[model samples]
Target: MPTLSESRSRLLVSEAGIPVSNWETADSTQEAVSLAKNLGFPVVVKLCGDEIAHKTERGLVRLNLKTEDAVEEAADELLSSVTADDGEVTLLVSEQIRGNRELIVGLVRDEQFGPCVMLGIGGILAEAVADVAFRLAPLSRSEASDLIDDLSMQSLLDSFRGEPAVDREALINVLCALGDLGSDQEVLSVDLNPLIVANGVPIAVDALVETVEG
Candidate 1:
């Protein structure tokens, strides 16, 4: 299995090839805090180690904070809950993705396609309404564009009321990056749900990267 870090999960997804975002690694609480501080306000803090599936389910994640002190508190809560008596722990703090909208983009391994791409309206919105879309890997710009249009809440992209329009190019880039990760790397699952958006900008709030056993 390819480690998300060693695999350069974010690096693999690019605007040059498709579209992408930035990522940083955190091996310690201090490091994660530093990263969160550098990334600026409204970021996420997560426990980024192996042997775990859903951080939220385990109470191993925190969201929407503006201070290092708050991050430290959240990190402590996550670290304490996810660690075993005999195991070590590592944390990853990400830039808080702010926006009124939330969305999910991920990849699933397929027997033939290797990796299949997925999209959905995220956060509580996705929960309330089951708006999701999927497509095969190695998609053309046209294919991706169509996939976006096919979404049930596609009109949310337009600048609603006084809100700004979502940076569609950026959103498409994130989805394509997930597809690329599944294609070029050996991954079991790539889940970035509640990839929050505010004023049309998207940032992955919670992520789950796992390896599939063959």
Candidate 2:
């Protein structure tokens, strides 16, 4: 199997109507700093490359960088780290988003079910919680709604603290699109974690796609 890079994965999902954070790719610390400045302070910086996945685990991700100096330092460290491994690297700078709710959306192929869409609570404890629901591909609007309602922690979607309730229609759209993508034989799986909700809109922060090898 072949896997799409983070940037490529995000692009593929975005083309399918999923909302993703705005990002720019850079090849050097200086370029990363410039991109970060252009995107504004308190941005996210990560090493990006075809072979570099699980950036957080590799210490390639820098978050909430609030100063040019900080961005420069992070970019330098990330570039050095990734380059040492692959001999080359690209940096990705994105606008930092603030959200308390994290969710996961994905697709997988099953022997009996064929393509299936999955929804679950996400974040560091995603595996621990294991609260997820699934539906077959090409989900109808009603099926999409049921998928959300099926989650063990449905309260997460309701208005909590001061945050507004998650936009159900937008969430439904994302799932339905994923369902459509799942139906493609070329697509093997998709892992979209930390699909953060900000001001009621869900934005995909990180994603990975596994595709059938030629």
Candidate closest to the true structure, highest lDDT: 2
lDDT of 1 by residue, 82-170 (tens): 65741444676666555677777777887876678888877755756878888998666667777788788877778865778878887
lDDT of each: 0.66, 0.88
- For model 2, the superposed segments whose C-alpha errors exceed 4 Å read 83-88
Q: Least accurate stretch of 10 residues (summed lDDT) in model 2?
A: 80-89
Best by TM-score: 2
Q: Pairing residues by index, what is the TM-score of model 2?
A: 0.95
Model 1's lDDT to the true fold? 0.66
